[model samples]
Target chain A: MTFSVEVNGVEHTTEPRPGQCLRTYLRERGCFGVKKGCDSGDCGACTVHVDGVPVHSCLYPAVRAGGHAVTTVEGLATAGELHPVQQRFLDAQGFQCGFCTAGFVMTTAALDEAQLADLPQALKGNLCRCTGYRAISDAVRGVTTVETACPGRAVGASVAAPAGPQVVTGTARYTLDVDVPGVLHMKLLRSPHAHARVVAIDTADALALPGVQAVFTHEDAPRRRFSSGRHENPADDPADTRVLDDVVRHVGQRVAAVVADTEAAAEEGCRRVRVTYEVRPAVTDPEEALRPGAPLVQATGNVVGEVHGEVGDVEAGFAAAAAVYERTFHTPRVQHASLETHGAVGWLEADDSLVVRTSTRSRSSPAARCATCSTCPPSRCGWWRAASGAGSAASRRCSSRTWSRSPCCNCAGRCAWSSPAPSSSSVPPRGTRSPCA
Target chain B: MDLHTVEQWVDARTVDAWRPGDAWLAGGTALFSAPGVHLRRLRDLGGTGWEPLVEDPDGRLEIAATCTVARLAAHPVALFGQCCRAFLASFTIWNMATVGGNLCAALPAGPMIALTTALDGGCLLLAPDGAARTLPVTAFVVGDGRTALREGELLRSVTVGPLPARTAFRQASLSTLGRSAALLIGTRDADGAMTLTITAATPRPHRLRFAVPPTAGELREAVEDEVEHWFDDLHGHPAWRRHLTFRFAEQIREELS
Candidate 1:
């Protein structure tokens, strides 16, 4: 099982388990430049050069690289100078969240003049959820000198990201990249039926597992309801969510949580817990749900509230206007689909106070919400906003302020959190020269 | 969770000792994209060192199962190149995905099926006992996400004969990077015979042959009567697929005639 390979001209030896992929193997060896988005190869977030050819490390077996040479975004730079692709990315400010920047850099660096002619098709694998394709195309085109300089700059003079060099070089650290000591992994068992009531949950089998630290159900957690969405004021939103509930309104709703020594152990523990459910009729369409009698999503009613806006005299304006168009548009409810999914880490400090790190825009809200759910003193809790490449909604209970060396859980409801970057605080030292100010 | 259940990996040079639960690994593009909890071992075939492409004296080209899409598209064949363009896969996917993998996936929206079947291609299959057999590309794919591949069998290569003297292709999609809703390709051989192949709009490629170009009305009736299933999915509706397939088929017949 011993795998010895040359990475960026240095030889390293690793013993990967049978199913360990190359993305995880590289990250364990401090090669954090290779990011893991979708374990599936569709995202291309884990692209690396295997024997001078770009391949998805998430799909490649760690043992497959035993005798081959590998290159990551961290290896793009020579002794002191940045690669032309990296330099152009920095100059054009082509990235926003920068989670997909390393993958883009790896693909763009290998492009030649002939391939540049088909640039759109060439860089299609790397998905930058934040920035549009214009800036990315301009950066790649600038390197080849195939097009003239774009005209017209905005009012303010152009400025590069403060952490642009570090991002391109794969030195910037996101929430998941931060290292914590003696942390336990948590996993949830979700409901398969959209509308159902949990009749009984037997957790005795799950607690018998070897590495499982704790198994929690609705009976053990707090009973207070809280709002999962973000609002200017926490009280402005309706309190329709609890840490765990007996009634499941939608599929994929959390039923119970398992905290264990490793992710594998947690996953295994989740599968062992058995639950009895009473399935109920469900409605999938909005109009159908609003009919005279439909399964209610909430205890109160199917409809929350209606809003009617008027800019002027509607009937008079329509009559006087030359032309008026009316149409009904339906927009599907879709996830923000950030490159990084929601994640958080929490632990008790030496002072016996709780500290939680997460990626969120509502700084004070998480601290306050964590304290309220933990039933601990607000002053004793420490909450730090994660330097997200892009923000995502991490769910309730996950950021709870409970003070324990054991696992504390958080849930990602429908919250979308995006954090703007170029801040120096998020950059980890990777021994690269700073970018031009 | 990750693929934590895989416990064994077998590196095989040939199809001699293949077993059940053994999956062949070429580019690992489609294999890793979806969940494969049933797979216990991956038999690495890229190590076999099969030559990517070869041209026989008869002007037929044999494409190895391990040949990447990018390599196949870069070759000098015009019809093959046009089909490769229909893939619409990124350079990264093009470099890692194999032509054999695409055909074996048997997706209703697969562009490789459209290309190879249009040019009268055949698949070379090798079973675990070292027995080899050949089947036309149209018969190789049985249904969606289903192939005629037997357990422990490996697809060796695909053979594409010389291109037709006159060929034309038409494709339509919902979006710029979306999967093809309907693809209609027509070719006229040197003997003045014509073949029309339709893909993406059906569960399998539907091909129509004629000694000479068929009449416009005949083409429409043949498509409407022969194709029982128009292939319904998220990319396009069955009604839309049928409409577009008929419209494109007539346009190709007119252009070739």
Candidate 2:
């Protein structure tokens, strides 16, 4: 069904099936600053101002945002000026990758100077993997003056004072905010058991659900396995993920997916689908998975691989030390609670190629893999396509080379090109030292 | 998105609209964090408007439940104001969070709970009917994420008596930037009746009262016996929380007496 939404003071009419989120809606309308790190509400990357208040837009329904003023990073700037928050971010070097910067800025903009004092508490919801947050805190505190209107400009540019309201007063637009016409809501039926093998599958009952449009099982999906790894060359790594799989290795592994007219209908379709499984032994602990007796988490065995690099020999260092502090610190598995939950909208173009819009780390390893992998070309890669679609597409290749020369050249750089093949002429000289060195 | 879409009613009528799947949306601080709630409708009771801090017909101080924690901390009263100022860690989010919302949220670490229960504050709940009932703050919270408010009932205000001649408060947390692990507030009335409220360590606020100021040994026993519902979560384990609570209670008792 079609719905009308007012975003950043402009009214736009779009169609979205029930369950369509506001994050996707905003991205489709060209508010590309909203990043999607985690699809769950934990990460504040998708935070936007809905009705002038900062909120994680990933979980909010597009229907819920109807008739509301949605302000995104795009809305933060108006009439060729930078919002004070954005300018402060630039001055403070608050962002490295710039993926989480928009969300951080939007969240900070929502807070007054007094609330900004509690930087750790206010930013607890927004997670940044880079720059360590010292700069972000500075930026939030630096923007003392409140603006009465949006300061319009390209976010990367330095501009004068913001003209908008000081406090973030409404629900913000995020990646899941996109509203597409005739879009179908999709839900994945995850495996309940951590480890199991499918004996038989049936979707006949699920297909009978009134609003169910399509049901995809292992047989209906492409046999090729794709990896969700955020690496530059995925082919160099393992492509272990599949749209649907008969063997479930994890609790949240997708077994089937259903598309329906409404989220409720999709949920019902997922519930109706039945499958017989042969339960198998499972290893939940990372430590046990390394032991010989433990059940393997993957067919390759439980060891996901290890990184062992030493600046100096630890045994010799310990022998030389007067005192050695030996302790094993355990860091628990933490979810990147990005306010905007992960979501993607995919539809077939006129040429029959699938066009998907999602919030993903730009210039990530996976994007590089898409560029190099034969099966999935760079043109089809989501990040590459998105970057190329925007202006200054040619600079992407130049930046990719520059990125490789300085850093590990993984997905962290803005370069859209795939990593050069080992045999390619573009490979840097073997003796050449990296800029970081 | 539209707060105006939800009709606003006065205190009594608003409580009557509460339903199984409905949530009471106050300042939207906690509710906005987890929007996955099943509640389709929210009862916005924040617009009840501000009520004066009154020295009621009885000498007790009546703080409107809708009063923000920032206001409570900034109030002219010495003891209450001191507790409120200490409660202000960087979370000015408390500026908008109402007294009723913090209590209803029922977090053991709620700063307001530490302040109110210490001063012997009682909750004034407006039931689904027009009737009103008052309960001591200690009995109001049953456990973590639980409260004694019946369905369709609303907390209108909190009534606290004039602080006893001597009062003192102490609180500690794991990290400088973390939630409270233990909060202790001690008060000794003019009659020398001493009351110590131990919060954050347990699921519910634990109050230990003595006819007169108790020795450190006597206060420790009362605290150990009264705080049966010890909290053990990611913030802290029960053992540490218990130990810290005991240590702080003793410190508070000595300082207050």
Candidate 3:
């Protein structure tokens, strides 16, 4: 259906699909600041002023926004003048990774002094993945000026992040903001059963879908095993994973992938790519997993490896100590819940070499792993960064593939030049790193 | 993340002539968050033309199905404001989440359920056949995430009577951002009758009344005997909920008395 809305004071008319949401529609229309941290309204990354009221655009239907006035981070600046909130954030050094900055700015800009008292409660919805709330709150509360020690360097000074002004003005770009042309959308068909063996995969139905480009399964991928958790050194973790495996280890594990022209088409293709599974007994408890007769998570064994360390002789240390205490504590598994999910865009170079840009910590490991899985030489693989956090292993387990000719919005291009942090010398490296752009 | 199965959308202004696989779209905060492969078409209620909120001459409030939590909080009804605080939703969520959506979601943690039920609220339901009926808030929710809503029936509005001059509220949760583990609300009627309602910690709201303010022992006995089942989930254990409910109930009684 044709949907028309006024965005950033410009009237935009577009034919949005029935299932399309305002979040995806706005981003597609070059409003890169509206991020999709969580498609659900839990995260306010997609917050925008709809008729002057902040609403999570992810939950708002694109068609429902017809004839409404919308204001995004990009609209905060008028006639090349910065909005007060944007300027305040810049002065306060309000962000670190800057993933959630635009949402916070949008919300804070609409607030008056009356609402500032409940600042914490008002901001409870928008989560910043990197920095603490002190700087952001200070920025919104108009605590702009801070004492600085050094004139040139501002060493140990509470200055704004290099990316602050761009972030607040809604011009900064993250991985998802990249406008890649003719990008193929990829979706995975995850296993529902925790422990199961893929008996058969019938892809004929999925392949029949109109826009389906490729349906990949274990048969299509290399049999080489590598750890999904990539460390600086490849030998640090167990090499126990393949690109696709016949044996599903746990629920939500990808068994097959569908690449199609559109996200909806890819998802429909994923749903259609049905596989027959032989369900096996699953072990959920860690103690049960260590039992002698427990089901093996890996073919080698459930126990990957063990490390034992001692600073001093245990018996001697205990005898010398007045008291000895030992307690077994259980720590739950944690995902590196970065505001921006892990994603990668890859396409073959003109010379047939593959180049990949991804949201990951280790730069070279993805290329090495991809080369290992695709039977390509390491020299033929190139790597780039898409944006990552300090410590998050969640993206390590899953690889987000952005295909060639996709809409690539290289955020680095916009910020790399005007970045306020004095490290302009690193700009040349980014230029060489982002080959696909 | 994409809604793959939704092929059709009907901008419904009315609740008539509903078809299969059709669902009402209110604020859509919960509906969009959930896996809705089963939903083929959405009947948009945004154009229903219902006033967000209204206060009749009788001092009773009529909250429209599309009324957002933020709007309801802005209303002068202080009791509702207290309940709105219990929602624990962010300003973004509050601006988007609706009162009817929370109640109709039938989640045990829904604060609207506790508020409306405790205040003797009634839901105005409109069936597909054009029949309309009013059901108390307590009878509307059958179980966790399950409501007594009939097929193709829509919640038009919820009417709540004037709040008691003397009212007390107490809520307990595992964490600041966590769902309510137990909620106790006490009210004193104009006639000096007392009503105690317990929610969140239970599968549904539990209510008890007395001609006069009951003693701590009487309140405790009534809660232990009447509250046959305590809602069990990750929010809190049933035992912990029962204990908290007992303690909070006493605090409410004392505060209201």
Candidate 4:
């Protein structure tokens, strides 16, 4: 049976792809605004209005959309004018990184004025990472003016963010939105057993599968070690990790990466690749990990880094003191929960220069900045500021100094002046390197 | 998850065709919630044209299998709001997930099972051969994710009681969001008797009755004796669910009493 859907007043009647989700269907059809943060409806990034009712489109079946009226973030505005909700968002500055803005807009569009009072309950399904929800709340409540929107900060001055219009109207492109034709989809075969050494990997079946491009194991990775830490002076950063590792230090570590023509092929290739493991005892505790006979996490000893600077005989100064006290302060390990997840797109230019686009906030280059180990010269490989936060960026060969904005509602064509981010960059890509999009 | 094997979707009301890999699609929530490559075809009930809800003159209610949770909560039945709130799901889930799907998913955390079991509800099931049978909600579910649904049988609707002059109190674990680890509902019948419906904490809904309000010790004893299969999963350990069930049972008992 033909699957028919009226999306944003346009009817699309086509043979439905088997088991396709409404989110993927809509996204594939140029509804770039309908984001998919968590495909399981955890994040409201894929929220859309199905027949005037808000729904997590990620959970809706594409075939089921037949005869349903679907409205996405892109459809909110009419006659090239912004919707009132979108306008209010621009006025209130209701976003941080704007990754979750589309979902918030869709959900807020369905709510009545009274629902704005209890946003925690009304917008319970949608989640935001950076804004702390204050600006979003202000926008939903239609609190115009910067001073009223946020009293303490920007009291008298009013300023819009880099991509507010595009963000609110769902026109801004994220790392996942970038499309390069011929880009092969890669799926990681994660180690199921924690602290196990991958003894053997049989990729003959995977390679035999149709559409299978390449199957990469730790044995095949470029052994040039690199650290994923943030250190301006590269010396302090420990070059511990690699593209892939035989010894899985933890569960979900990348054991192999299967490249294929399609996502399904890559996933099936990953499943077909058999792996054998040697279980090892794990040291889960910080104290136990530092013990004398503990299993070493790295080839080197466990004490990876030590900070000690002798300032004019510190021990003698302590001895001369009236009394000496010792204590060890403890703090929980923190993670930078950026609104945008770690993602990047890499491709080789005609000149064989690698250009990568990622959500690297204010950083220069991914290959030059994030993946720095002197393997690739900084001039040949570099990144420019793209999306929000100091997330990630990489490059091996490219001109690295253009600070172009991502295409959005206000600056869609204008932003394409200097090697701009792809407007409809879906597919037709070249080269390789995408870490978690 | 993609049901790649699914080749056709037949309306549930049209033909009595039952294949080995056929699955009933009502709301398609839990069924489509995750991947199921085994599902070959979907038997959809959207074309069944069954009334979502039917009200009896004697205050009885017959809720159709396709009744969405949001519709039921919006219903005038006040106790329904209390039971529907047990879902802890957002409006998105409530608008899509169906009552029959909840019961047939047979998940221990299904609030519909808990609600029906408490109200002494009965299930109306129909076989592909046109044979019909009605079973108590307590007997409908046998274990976690396992239902008494025979192959090719369809759960048509559920009939819930004449809820008048009945006092009910519900307690569930976690926040007002997501799945419940433990949910307990205590109701005082018009006859001055009480029943505690324990759910989410156990494999199946448990209905414990007492002519009068049971003492804390008596309630604890009945709970400990009756519920042998306390559910254990990421939601909660069996012991934790048991502890919370017992604790909520006492609190609900005191309040209802």
In angstroms, how far off is A114's CA in candidate 2?
A: 5.9
Which structure is stronger by TM-score: 2 or 3? 3
Model 1: pairs clashing at backbone N, Cα or C within 3 Å: A391-A417, A391-A418, A394-A412, A395-A411, A395-A412, A397-A409, A398-A409, A398-A410
The CAPRI-style docking tier of model 1 reads: acceptable
Enumerate the candidates' DockQ scores in order.
0.48, 0.14, 0.64, 0.40
Model 2 C-alpha lDDT per residue in residues A1-437, reported as the tens digit of each score: 34678887889888533334566667667665666555445556777887887766664545556667898887888786788777777656565445577778888888866557767766766777655787677667674322234466455554322211221211223323444565666666778899999887799989898878777677654466655442444444466644466788878666776767766677778888998999999988887887788997668776655788878788999999999999999987553332333344444334423233333334444344334422345455443122111112212222221111111112211111211211111211122111111
> Which ten-residue region of model 2 chain B has the weakest summed lDDT?
B1-10
Q: What is the descending TM-score order?
A: 3, 1, 4, 2
lDDT tens digits by residue: candidate 4, A1-437 = 56689999999987556566788888778887888665666678888999998888877767788989999999999999898988888888887667788888888888876567767867877887766788888898888755433656655566566567788888777766755566565667787776888899999999999987777777765566655453455577676765566787777677776767776787789889999999998877889999898987787877768787887988899999999998999998654444444445554445434445655443342354433432334555434334442232321211111111111110111111111222223444332221121
Q: Give me the candidate number with maximum TM-score.
A: 3
Candidate 1 iRMS, in Å?
A: 2.2
Model 1 misplaced stretches (Cα beyond 4 Å): A143-155, A204-211, A313-329, A375-377, A392-437, B14-20
Evaluated at residue A222, the lDDT of candidate 2 is 48
Clashes of each: 8, 57, 14, 17
Candidate 1 chain B, which ten residues in sequence have the lowest lDDT sum? Answer: B1-10
Tens-place lDDT per residue, model 4, B1-257, is 24445667777777766888888888766766675756778887877889999989987789999998889989876778777866755777677888998999898988899888888889999999999999999999889999999999999999988773565655566555557888777778788889999899899989999999989999889888998888988878888888888778888888888
lDDT of 2 by residue, B1-257 (tens): 11212222123234354556565555554554442335445565554565837677767888777777667766766766555544423323444456777788898888778788887889888776668999998878777878889987778888888757888777777876467888888888889898888888888887888998899888877876776678888888889998898888888878877
Which candidate ranks first by DockQ, i.e. highest? 3
**Model 4 CA lDDT for position A209:** 93
Q: What tens digits encode model 3's per-residue C-alpha lDDT throughout A20-51?
A: 78888889889988988877887788899999
Interface RMSD of each: 2.2, 8.3, 1.5, 2.3
Candidate 4: segments with Cα more than 4 A from true spot: A145-158, A307-342, A362-365, A369-385, A389-437, B1-23, B37-41, B56-59, B125-134, B142-154, B176-181, B215-217, B229-247
> TM per model?
0.88, 0.70, 0.91, 0.83
